[model samples]
Target: MTDLIACTRAEFARLRRWPAFWIILGTWIVLNLVFAYLFNYLAYATGSSMRMSNGQPRAILLQQMLPAAVPEVFTQGMAMFGGALMLVLGALVTGSGYGWGTWKTVFTQGPSRARVAGGTVLALAVVVVALVLTAFVVDTGVAAIIGTVQHQSLALPGAGRSLLGILTGAVILGMWTLAGAVIGVLARGPALAVGLGLVWVLVVENLLRGVASIFAPIRAITDHLPGTAAGSLAGAMRTISGEPTPGVLDILSRPASFVVLAVYIVVFAVAMMWLLHRRDMA
Candidate 1:
């Protein structure tokens, strides 16, 4: 336990200084801020000249940008854009170690192979939590600003609901991060793993989803996909707020979404550990 803690700390220390990690994180924050607030605000500002995307009136659009909508804004982008960026971060953090020989050096002579993998994953978990909380805070600030400017009430989302939203974001993002870690270990390089991960997240699953709509039977399998599960979890939060937010789905019940995401995270973590512990580093 002590050794694992030490390993996690070491990994976190290194990741904090990693420019790539910051770049990925920064990108997500900016994307979340823009998509959740900027676009909505712009649409609201356009007034009667433009149609509201969700068919809600301009007033509803403004309400969506108020502080009380923080929980919704916190998770609105997570299913698609946030998850993709996180996968990139995880892939680069783990797979890049191979290209730089960090994994080889550490696994070959430094510590137990399991220990190193555990530490890296534990560290990545921290990154996942950091990303979620950062988004929440930033969205809250922006929403508060908009609320004040528009003279709306600054009331916040319910505490319990907000906590649940945070947990949902962590679960959804955690699954993707671990999936990227496994892919990194599998490909043994950052570029290939990131390419494959992005394709699966951004291209492949989306195409399958379109096909599934045409072939009802395909919906069964697509319903269980990682992206689907992640999107469902985010949608669950939206359900509480009374509408499906952008880039999410309301296909699965909340419990089922949590179960599916938990299963994927475990499978990915186990696969990554097995590959690291048993495969040849050469």
Candidate 2:
């Protein structure tokens, strides 16, 4: 435990100086801000122009971008960008040890293979949590400002529920981060890990989900994919903001989604540990 803590501190210190960490984090914040602005604009524009079936002006803007709706905005933004950013950062942090030829040096410093691997995972988890919290705070502040300018009520509603959603979304992203750590170890390079992880997330998982929708047999298996499970976990946040639950593709119940996410985290952690123990640093 002492060795693990020491190694974790070293990892954190290294992360403090990592330019990629700040770059990815900065990009995540900026992109989400842009999306928040666009979402508000669309809601306001539609409300100003459209009417309900009863011929009343639609309150689409208030409905979607009210201060009370800030949590929903944050949730959606994290669902879209948080997982991907976590994957990239995870890869960069773990794979860089090899890319910089520091893996062997770290091993020579007296920590067992498991201690080093465990410490790295622990450090990445801390970073993921911090990033998630930062997103919530920044997005909520941006939405509040926008709502104030639009003359909407600035009171946050359902604060408890919104917080629950944020935490759940964070956990899902944390799981993705660990999975990326495994990919980093396997690929042994940041560039390759990021490329492979993105392809898996943006291409393969998406394609599988789409195919699952059209083919009954494929649907059965695709529902069990790690990406689908993560989506299910993140999608649950929508219900807190009174949005419709995600459809057939998720298949798993909320409880089941949590279980699946836990399973994935455990499997990835075990795989990473096994590889670290069995493989040579060089």
Candidate 3:
């Protein structure tokens, strides 16, 4: 336990100097500011109540752009747009370690390969949590400030739930990044790792979905695929179709999606260890 903790700390120190974290964090702040302004501007244009539920004036303005519920709107927006960007950020988090070529050094530092893998995951988890927390704080602050300027209240039902969803979604988004890092460790190159991660997420997943439609057996299992399971875990909102893909039971009752994600993490960690044991390092 002490060894793991020490490794975790060492990994954290290494990741702190990464440029990827800063770049992603900066983009997150900028996006939050821009979107908050747009949301407030739309509220002003619509001349909506902008009033608190208690009939008092509000300090934060929550605008309704889509016909769906507020929580649903936020969910879809986060999953489709912000979430995608975050996925890339996740990859960058793990990939940056590869770029620095430090995982090898980590393995050589008396800790076993497994310890190094655990340290990498521990560090990445901390980074993901911090990144997501920062995004939510910056976004909420920007919206609140703008709404206060406009004399609009910013409270909404399920706001807290939506925030939690974003945080979990960010973690789920990191799965691909983690996968790529594993691949990067095996391949000893960043290009293949990034390309494979993106292709799997953007192309292969979609292709799998399309193929599953015509093949009954594939359809049976494809729903549990990484992309599908990530979407399920994320609980992203869809409007054109108000249908929830995973359903309440699937998310709350069944643990398959989470299990799959866990498997991915474990598999990659083991694979990285295997690579470390076999491969030559400088």
Candidate 4:
């Protein structure tokens, strides 16, 4: 346990200095700022809210920019767009080590492969949690500014609801991060791992879902895919906010979506460990 904790701290320290990590993390934050708040705020100011308000009243555009909407609105990007970026962060976490021979050096220094994998995962989880918390803070701040400037109420989400929303964001982010870690382990380099991960997340999944609509067997399989599960998970809290986002769907029951997402998170974590164990790090 001590070794694992040490490794986790070490991994965290290393990741903090990584430029790619900051780039990807910053991108997610910027995306949240733009799509989640900026775009809607623009629509509200320009009287284009009717067209961009998901078929709701123009007032909803203004309302969504207020503090009470932060919980769900802040998470709208994590479904697919944010998840893809997190995957790249994950790929860099593990795959870049192999590319630079860092893994080989670490293996020679006597830590067990399992310990290193665990450390990587633990550190990644911490990062994921931080991302969610950071988004909540940023979103709430922006929402508050919007509310105050517009003279809208400054009421916030309930403490319990806000906590739950943060947890939901962490879970979604964790699953995709680990999925990227697994690919990083399998590919053994950041470039290929990133390319493959993006291809799967961006191109392949969409194509498969489109095909699945017409083919029954494909539909059955697509229903359980990780992207589908993530989308459903993102949609799980949609009833609370009324914000519509791309890649957020209701294909699975809320319970089923959570279950599937949990399964994928576990599977990817274990797969990452097993892959690191079996492969020659040297």
Best by lDDT: 4
* Every candidate's CA RMSD: 1.9, 4.0, 6.9, 1.7
Instruction: Order candidates by TM-score, high to low.
Output: 4, 1, 2, 3
In the range 1-282, model 2's lDDT, one tens digit per residue, is 899999899889898887888898888878766655554465466654422212223364455556676665565655435677888888887788789988878787768989988988888878877877787777667767767777778787586967776677677778878888889889988999999998887788878878877887888788877777777766665533333322212367778888888888889888887887788887
Q: How much lDDT does each candidate structure score? A: 0.85, 0.73, 0.55, 0.87
The all-Cα superposition gives candidate 4 an RMSD in Å to the true structure of 1.7
User: On TM-score, who's better, 1 or 4?
Assistant: 4
Tell me the lDDT of candidate 1.
0.85
The runs of at least 3 residues in candidate 4 whose Cα sits more than 4 Å from the true structure, single-residue gaps closed, are 49-56, 240-243
Mind giving the per-residue lDDT tens digits that candidate 4 earns over 159-201?
Answer: 9879878988998899999999999989999999999999999
- TM, every model: 0.94, 0.87, 0.69, 0.95
Superposition error at 204 for model 2 (Å)? 0.6
Better of 2 and 4 by lDDT: 4
Error of 2 at 224 (Å): 1.8
lDDT of 1 by residue, 184-241 (tens): 9889999999999999998999899899999998999999999999898888776333
What is the full ranking by lDDT, best candidate first?
4, 1, 2, 3
Worst 10 residues of 4 by lDDT: 49-58
Q: lDDT for model 3, on a 0 to 1 scale?
A: 0.55
